[model samples]
Target chain A: MKITNVKSYLVEDIVKPFTWQVDRPGSGDGRDPRKNFSCVMVLDTDEGISGYAKGPKGRIMMDLVERRFSSDLIGMNPLNSEKIWEKCWDTDRLEEYPLYAMAMVDIAVWDIKGKKAGLPVYKLLGGYRDEIPAYASTTSYDTLEEYRDVVEASLSAGYPSIKLHLRYRDVKTNAKLCEKVREWVGDDFSLTLDASGLWNYTDSLWFGRVLEELKFEWYEEPMREFELESYKKLCDKLDIPILAAECSDGSHWNAAEFIRRDACDIMRTSTHYKGGFTGGMKVGHVAEAFGMKAEVHGGGHNNLHLCLALPNNTYYEDLVIDVEDIEAKGQGQLKFENGMYSFKEQVAGVGIEYDHDELETISIQKYEKF
Target chain B: MKITNVKSYLVEDIVKPFTWQVDRPGSGDGRDPRKNFSCVMVLDTDEGISGYAKGPKGRIMMDLVERRFSSDLIGMNPLNSEKIWEKCWDTDRLEEYPLYAMAMVDIAVWDIKGKKAGLPVYKLLGGYRDEIPAYASTTSYDTLEEYRDVVEASLSAGYPSIKLHLRYRDVKTNAKLCEKVREWVGDDFSLTLDASGLWNYTDSLWFGRVLEELKFEWYEEPMREFELESYKKLCDKLDIPILAAECSDGSHWNAAEFIRRDACDIMRTSTHYKGGFTGGMKVGHVAEAFGMKAEVHGGGHNNLHLCLALPNNTYYEDLVIDVEDIEAKGQGQLKFENGMYSFKEQVAGVGIEYDHDELETISIQKYEKF
Candidate 1:
């Protein structure tokens, strides 16, 4: 069916704020918590079906959609996702359309396609599995003790593995913490590290050596994504799989470079950052072709769909900040039980739930284009 | 239909040999002409339909199919091209299956798929056009006068554009020749240069500046394909489109790296070097996504199908070693008339004509696996 209208809602304070512990001394007391706002987009079609997705949480994302994409999206068939994706990328050389904006449109269009086909998004993408093991991915915390407690709590809450996002600048302390946590979690537990693209070559080497000794599952983004040469060196010097290209610009295109250079062992992909399912799957297939894995970067219904569909992807990431907050919110349709995340059976589309009343009350701005 | 058997034939002296002019001192009189042998691959299915494709011209390609790939092909469905392609790449990390070997299987599979569907391969690939403009691509020649004669002959033979494969090591002489040819052809005719990945960085820059001044359509592989950083610098320095990654490994993956780094303005792709139709299409889509052209690298029925199917690819290449030779062996099925290559209407599969009696006469080795 043809898309009749495109709508975006800028909602405030819908998600709980989450903070990251600071590593650099003068970079403020701690990293600011994520803004508890979201840009929710909806595409209304002539068949009376609406597709929904969450875009990057801000006015900028909404403004980009309204000014640059909404008009172009009108009168297009939602089922022609590839054509629409190409249309959006037609101006990429100059516009450099942010991944999130493209992701929002593509994800919404796939949602419409799935609903029409009477299948979930993952099935439409060629499903690999209904359940996937999940890792507890954490925001950086202040102390070693805090890390230990979160690791214990994550295990108790049914997570099979955990990935530590440690203080950016303090390599030594992070290494020590990794060693201590490995001891606490014991030998069989799957533990990995995400340095958040913060280390220099020498520092990354030093830190990577420690991870190797500790038998960490993977060493992630120790250097900035653009430092491909450095990443190549790291891959050569260290045995640990280097997971990279999480926030890099060119999506599958950039990920292909990392693979070609032997720079990254695991590729980071998400509907939120990699132009939704279409771009994410391309990266996944490219990695798979090279005998590498493309890991889902975040925890959400969209990412859950991807984790299920991608054969090369091993684990779904369940973001854990405060244990209490995670317990209260509860993971949506993707239920975590027995240390695995499983999709609810027979659900069509992306299977994301929307609270219309909450969305209406929290929306600060609404834009509709026909 | 289930693939029942895979067969390979090594046939000798099936093609006319053509020489390449040498550029470096003591590199021998001229580069040895291409071997006159060819490896023909056929996939026999249970449904009594057989698919055909020409592999890289040698016994090694036949050996690769027999020793590594034939067993895997026995029970596969020929229509499941993507699955078979992925199965081949399953060992890419260690085995590093050469592009031509993979291309042979993929192209043969597509042939079976198209014949089964009663359509041309281009139509199965989502047909973009029935015809594409053709460029006469010349082999390197010793003298400037010989190059001038070939360019004149190509124009008379219904070619609108011509790409010069020039003496690689002599940049100054090549530059002078480019200027002379441009002046002879006038400003409107499309003239481009291919250096065959021979120049060093400094020489590449100097030659590129001359090409830019002469307004060549593109400067191709001025430096080695592995020297990506040098290509990136050349792209930044030259305003003319840089066509690259023609002989590079990794197919769409490597092509993606060039696009991501802005190393080339146009990408070089062909079924013979990329992984056949599937791989060529992926590279085409990747370039299209970035608003770049993916030029077909060589001439043949396979490359012709790609030129018609890919929206961003502009011209089909018609390799012209000598005017007399090309005139005697006219392009097959893909007719070149009035400056364009057009496919025959209602032809199924790749529409390649094979002389079975000649193949039998020239066959030196035959292999079959069931």
Candidate 2:
């Protein structure tokens, strides 16, 4: 079918109040705002079916598209998505042009295409399953007490696993936070640590050893993303799986390389950056081919779209998001059966409704057509 | 300086008979009305001295700003660009929000900060270099004869080095393109290949070894981006310096990891997607710190800003963009002396003058006021 539109939105809120990772210097300090909940997007189609995907923000993505590359996409067929991807990639004159945004345009268009084709987005690329398993990903709690409280809350909510955000700047605070989380969560649960790419290779290695002793399910971005050697080194020497936390990897090419090179085992991805139903399906194909676990990086309205569709998933991460945060609109879209998410019975696109006017209210009025 | 305004424009040229990409096998194949030149942004300011930064587009990035993230940005101190960046990132609540676009908002705000501080954006980031080198990078010509004509023209124009875009789908095309290019350029002159990540590891090794025998300067995206093993396999096994294409990098963090892991010899980056001047500069710093040469991926007027003030760069690739394709007025803001580009001494704040009427004429004119 011919494609009709490529619209971007500045949606404000979903169901969950934007949660944040607050890294305090000491015990009982204020929150850190460097990694706050920010922007997202929604795409609409001519067939009255629309889909939404969350990202860092469309402001940057939109600019590149409307300003430099809109002509790359204008009026064309929607079903022939493969060609569109190639054309965009071909015209990607700038190496630094955000692949994620361009990818989203492809994804949103694909979502619409699936609706038009009367097939689920994942099925378009040959999905093997209808649901995926999920784990619980946590953030920096203020103190050991808070950390323990949150970990218990998440585990009790039915998540079989959990990932703790660990920042080493304040050793004593971090030590206590880790100790409390371990003691509260106990041994049977799958616990992990994400250093958030703050530590150096050595620092991460040393801490990772300790984390392994504590039995972490995986170590997420323990070191910065660029240190492939360190990641490989850690993977080679350590027991934990090195997860690319929230990294903008839409394809499993990197993860495939890791597996091909015998460098890594886990690939962290999300719909906002990588796990859109389409990307998830495509990337999953590669991950499965490699016998590696496709770890879903949490974000946006990550319901059961791609997770359930995946066959090589390690676990679906809750990302420490609250259930109440799933706005009533997105509530039935996916079911959290005993902490594991299952998609709704409805065949709706994305299966989530956003409050259009509410989205408008949150917009900073950056620009409006007069 | 308090931020007072944020403006984004989808500008186009009033004169050119533009062509949007038409072969939409998948996504936007030159969708609707076709024209040239487009841009989107978030213009921030105090009472005086307005600053602009390129922002992300689409539902995800825009949704974040429109939904709730903008409130944190509005009425904030504009001069604290770094602080503002921290704020935008820190306030993120969802697990998977599009980060590239949010990063753009932060970068644009930083641009405002630099402008308000009465300093060039590079200077604000602790201006590391005084001048950056640039090379002439281009696509495959119709034939070796025609290719030589272009190369001869560049040589006469005074470029010390040149690059050839290799789009060979098979070994024959690859060898033909390389053979023609090497033959046309001769042995004394230096040149590189842009494989566009078309080959596999084995193919990469074979192609690289062939290029090395031919004495080609370096091969780019030899075996796909993120194929670290392929890159390392080629680098360690084959002695050629590989240029890391942007498609392989998920973000600066991944690029950093690629470098740390000894991924590429030359860092090929673009200011388009990686968050304008701020993020691009940060990436440049990473490349510099790693002892790799930094090359701006694409060319437009803004690239002139990056190449200037930055030292230790090998080339200003995308050097000769289709200026006719540029959205800004008077594309001659960049003055290249020989192969070297001279920065504007008289210009300030990106030195870009965007025309509102032109934007209206070329743009589909979606929402203007946030």
Candidate 3:
């Protein structure tokens, strides 16, 4: 079906305060984490089927999508998803990373694909599994006791695995904190660490040794993603599966280089940062060919479906500041039971139908032509 | 002064038909060139002083500039050109190709910089020289005779150099045409060739040997820009300086890799294609540091000013289907003198004050909020 219009709306009321170890001082870009808001992108077709996807920090994404993507997307057929994805990528001259707007449009287009087929997007994505284990990716805490308490609480709350978003500035302290969380959870529970690329080679080397001794499951972005030399060196030494490619802008073609180089043990990707379903799947497929696991970063129905579709990905990251905030904002039907999260078989499209009343809580920032 | 707003208007009546060797059948994207339009980008400030820049293909650029750039730019100082440039680049996750809207904003910001300082943008851009040799970069002609006549016409028109945009499908014919144009212009006249990357290594290798034998001035995008191996191999085999990286997305950092790898002998960059004055200058500065030339691609007041500012660039490319089309479309004030083109230094900004009467002839497609 021919697309009629593409519009983006900024919803500010639902902004959730966030802090990550990667966002702390000295983290690259030095951008302290702020309250994250949602920018919902809607693609309307002449056939009367409309698909929408939500992204964090809607303010920035909305502008890029409207300005860069609308004109290219407005008149094309929604079913030509591959061509549309390529058009968006080529329009920006195929940057190293994926455009959030393009990725969101890809999700919206997949939503349209599912709606037309009378199935959920995951099914369209090959439906490898209906469920996967979910890990609690927590925010960085100030004290060692805080890390221990958070780990214990997550275990009590039925999370079998919990990833530590450690204080990156003090690697010694972060290493001690990782040890404390592991001691609290013991060896049976899944423990992972995300340094958020805050460490240099020395710090990463020092902390990676501690994680290796502790037998942590995976270490994500312990050093800068661009520091390929450091990543190669670190991956060589660490027994823990070193995950990367989260910083790979969005092209799987670029991701393929990392795969070829033996850069990391696990590949990190998601729908928001990668180009969309088509792009995300491309990266996933590449990872599969290389005999490596592609960990889908970020949590959403789209991500969950992607994880389900790809046989290589191990877990879906359920990132939360507080588990209660999930219900406070009406994010979606993200059901968590006994350390795993799964979708409730969405009947049509992406299946995230925002509550009308909740949507009314936030002001409709702007809506205009293609 | 704070930027009050950022607005873009699409001037539709002035679309020029262009076909590069890159747009030919089996050459990459395979989309034939159409009548290209211009998008005029204006960055207005609180003090009532405004800066503007023009780019080809207004429909896509207009939407992006208005939607993505306006919000981040509106309340910021126009003098924070570097910061504005980085903000735009980071917002899009820093694509490899220049963000056209960001580059235009950079031009407009520089326009404001010049206006505020009451100097031409070229003067502010180091004012390396007042005059640079002008070359006639022509469209593809059907036959060799048509190409010969155009070279004669351009030479008769007082242009010092001519770059042949040759038919790339047949390397033998293209090589013959290059030799023909060199003979037609004689050994003293500057003769360059742009294949728009229509050749593979075998064709480029075969064609490059011919250009070497003929002693052509420069070979532009003789092969794929991304094929580093092909570029390196070609550059090693050919004596003529291989001009490349015109397709380097938009970041100078990525362009730096090409220089580090010795992929091309000459660098190809432009204002709108390279992320505006700030981003384009960064690439040029890197080229300067590397002891190589940064040849600004495309033609407009923005590129002309950039060429005037840079020490390494040898000529300004004046691309046109017909010389009259340049004046007819009111593109810029490019005065052709004895074998050169130069601007009668305007009072301030980019110095291209569009003829108010000529602007009246085209429709102002859209004007709205940042």
Query: What is the per-residue lDDT of model 1 for residues B1-370, given as tens digits with 9 covering 90 to 100?
Result: 8999888888654344544535221211111233344679888999988899986534546646765568668899998999998767543322334577789899999999988998999999969999888888887777888888888888888788989887546777887888899988889999888887666889999988898899989989876565566788888988888999887666787777688778899999889778899999998989999999999888888988999999999988888877785574355566777888877567789887566667677788888885
Better of 2 and 3 by TM-score: 3
Model 2 compared with the native: what TM-score?
0.69
Instruction: Give the chain A TM-score for each candidate.
Output: 0.94, 0.80, 0.90
In Å, candidate 2's interface RMSD is: 8.2
Q: Write the per-residue lDDT of candidate 3 for residues B1-370, one digit (tens) a residue.
A: 8998766777754235554454232211212234334677777788988887777545546545654566668788988888887677655532222366567778889999999999988888889988888888888877777777677778877777888887557887777788788788888877788887676788888887787777778888866464555677788887889999886553686566577557888887778667887777788988988889999898877888888888988888887575454333223466667656568546587887664346545746755574
DockQ of 1: 0.01
True contacts kept of 3: 0.02
- Candidate 1 clashing pairs, residues 3+ apart or interchain: none
lDDT of candidate model 2 versus the reference: 0.57
* RMSD in angstroms between candidate 1 and the native structure over all alpha carbons: 25.4
**What lDDT does candidate 1 reach at residue B30?**
14
Clashes within 3 Å, all models in order: 0, 97, 14
What TM-score does model 1 achieve against the real structure? 0.54
lDDT of 2 by residue, B1-370 (tens): 6776555554443332322213211112122333333335565555666655444233334444444445566687866666775555433323234345555575566566666666665566555554454566655444556556666666666667877764336766668767776776678777877776666787877888788888877788865565665676567776778878465443466567677657788776656545456556777778888777766776654565666645655566643222222222224666566556655464445555455566456555433334
Best by lDDT: 1
Better of 1 and 2 by DockQ: 2
lDDT value, residue A23 of candidate 1: 23
Q: Which prediction has more favorable lDDT, 2 or 3?
A: 3
> Cα miss at B354, model 3 (Å)?
8.1
